[model samples]
Target: MAIVLTVRDSSGLKLAALATGFVMASLDVTVVNVAGSAIQQQLHASLSELTWIVDGYVLVFASLLMLAGGLANRFGARAVYLAGMAVFFAASLACALAPTAGVLIAARLVQGAGAALFMPSSLSLLVFSFPDKRQRTRMLGLWSAIVATSAALGPTLGGLLVSAFSWPSIFLLNLPIGVAGILLTRRCIPPVGGRRVRLAVPGHVLWIAALAALSFALIEGPRLGWLARPVLAAYVVLGFAAAALVTRERRAEHVVMPWNLFRGAGFTGANLVGFAFNFAVYGGMFMLSLYFQHARGAGPFLAGLELLPMTIWFPLGNLVYSRIAGRIPNGVLLTVFLLVAGVASLAMAGMSTDTPYWVLAVAVAVANVGAGIISPGMTAALVEFAGVAHANVAGAVLNANRQIGTLVGVAAMSVVLGTVTDWNRGPGLSFLLLGGAYLAGAAGAWWLIARSERQARNVRR
Candidate 1:
């Protein structure tokens, strides 16, 4: 019989260590948004620059995730997890002490690389430690709850720290957590054997180049002129790289991604939906963070308080949806919630400078209600479609795509808001654009899910 770890068991320490890392990764997603205004003022960064500051971490994290999983498989999850913590520790310190925005962005990149390394391996440790399926599910449930709480608390926690100290405190806070987590993991988790795994070098290179070039082109086009040499060159690079990535994935035996997965009904659409979901949700939150702070003249504490509804409702909505998910059609659930979220986001576009705080909060809460439902459902669909053989890498792929959505959302929002120097008008226009994108994604998801259902019925008949 496989040993089960409860709170009282020594093996529970392994769960604790893994949870700590998850908290850190999850917290950073929203925490940095609360600090956005402070960082902008302190570092004298422009809109596009600030967007990069927020997205640079996510971009690297998403890009390297698959490779990180491969590395962990080849070199053992424990070793990779420890090394990730070490890198994260050093990078956090660097971020805290960074003298300029460029330096901070560089440090954030490294921090993301570390997170990419640890995030997947942390899950690996948990699964390896808990051989019993029921026990593992319960443990994962606890871990998921902890992650949700951390993400929800990020803005409030960041606000307090930024108010009491400065923006740097957000990064500095990771230091102690990292140290404790490493110590616990080393003491609690037994070492697992490594396997031979091939790295997808070509796929990685193409994807990185394509995403980087596309973002750079979009971000710089307004300031540099769309037809400017640099902007044109970036677009050219993006097109070529994206084409090459598609070709490379199709041809490679042991690629970073499997092209065959795209053949499944709703598979590609689900991934795209994941991207759009995060683009609207996370990207919108980032935009609101700046709007609350800059245009409304709210302090960090107040801004965080204002944004609480969105964060708080996310997990609550998830919990509520969980009870109903099995009873309802996944497609109907995904489509309905996405449509609701999209419409609510569009409603937010109507907000004027004179709009009341409570009104804004209500709108954000409504949007998050949709997010909460769709988030878990999205993962379930991706995993179900990918099936068991590709199960190991399914989450990684979905998350990577979701992060890419974040990167694009932030970049797109910046492109919209960056064009308008006036803060008051920028947010409303950006919301309108994002709302439109979300609606399009919803339609796509609906069609994809319907097609998948149709195929399933045909098979059964």
Candidate 2:
């Protein structure tokens, strides 16, 4: 009875700590977006510099997540989680104090490294903390809600911080949360055993190079002209790095992205959908911020308020979907959600300077509902398709792909808008491309779902 009560008493504190880490991770994805204008003005940043400030963090975070998972497995999750929080806290301080775009980008990179360490470890801790199926589901549901809410609310929170204070306030916001999470984790979470795994060094190096070069080429392509010598060189480097990554991974026994996971129908489809989701959604969010501020001439606070429609639906939709997630087939749910998002993108594509705010709000709200639906379903499909032993690595790969999608999405849209002298045409073109990508993702999800069903029937026969 005493043990049961202790578990019950400490569970909430543990949940708070774990969710704090996740919130910090998710918040950074969008918070910096709202602060873009302020950061630009204060630092006298170029467009490429601003892009790097945002993409640099995600690039490092995505590149190192797999290695971070391995580290978590080698060291205990509790120890690694605390260490990650400490690093994240220190990095946040660095971000808040950065004086130049170069300094900010470098700090953001270190912050991503710290985030990479904690994210997977925090998930591992959550899994170990709740051994019971029901409790696990509830905890996961709570975790999902918190993460969704953070992502949803990030822009508004960032706008408020940047409006009332300055851009640095955005990074400063993470300080108190990080400190509290570290203290709670040290006090409340129990130590768990870890496994020994080999680090895939060659694969890591190749991936990091490939992604960084690709991002650089994409961001600089529009500014430098696509065929410029530097842009061409970056593309060449990207191609070589990508080819080498494939070769190195194929030959390695302990790989960062195990090719076998891709063989499963649901796993492949989940990753594809994850990529498309981030590409369109996050990219669109960045574009929307620019449109509101630059094109529409809205202030930071009002621009965030304009986005409230979509943000509000994210958490509410997640709550509603969690209740039905078990009853629905993941493939079907994923397909439907992708379709919804695609449709929303299409709706947004018709916008012009004359387009009313209500019309845009409706379209964005639909997309938020799609995001809410797909997030948890993607996780479920990964676990179901990969099985328990492979779930961790499967998740890391999916998330990495998702972050790459985010980088590509943002860079691509920025390139389009940057190159086109006409604001009226360029932004709309980006939306059209995003809509097409979302539909392609929907088709892929449907194919995987049908294949899985057929395989299930064959097995029964």
Top candidate when judged by lDDT against the true structure: 2
Q: What does candidate 2 score on TM?
A: 0.94
CA lDDT scores, all candidates in order: 0.79, 0.80
Using Cα atoms with residue i matched to residue i, what is each candidate's TM-score against the true structure? 0.89, 0.94
Tens digits of per-residue lDDT for model 1, 344-367: 878977676788888888887877
Error of 2 at 115 (Å): 1.2
Residue 65, model 2: lDDT of 83
Q: Lowest-lDDT window of 10 residues in candidate 1? A: 1-10
Off by over 4 Å in 1: 1-15, 123-142, 187-192, 321-325, 449-461
Report the lDDT tens digits of candidate 2 across residue range 235-281. Answer: 89899999888887877888877788787877888888888888887
Global local distance difference test of model 2: 0.80
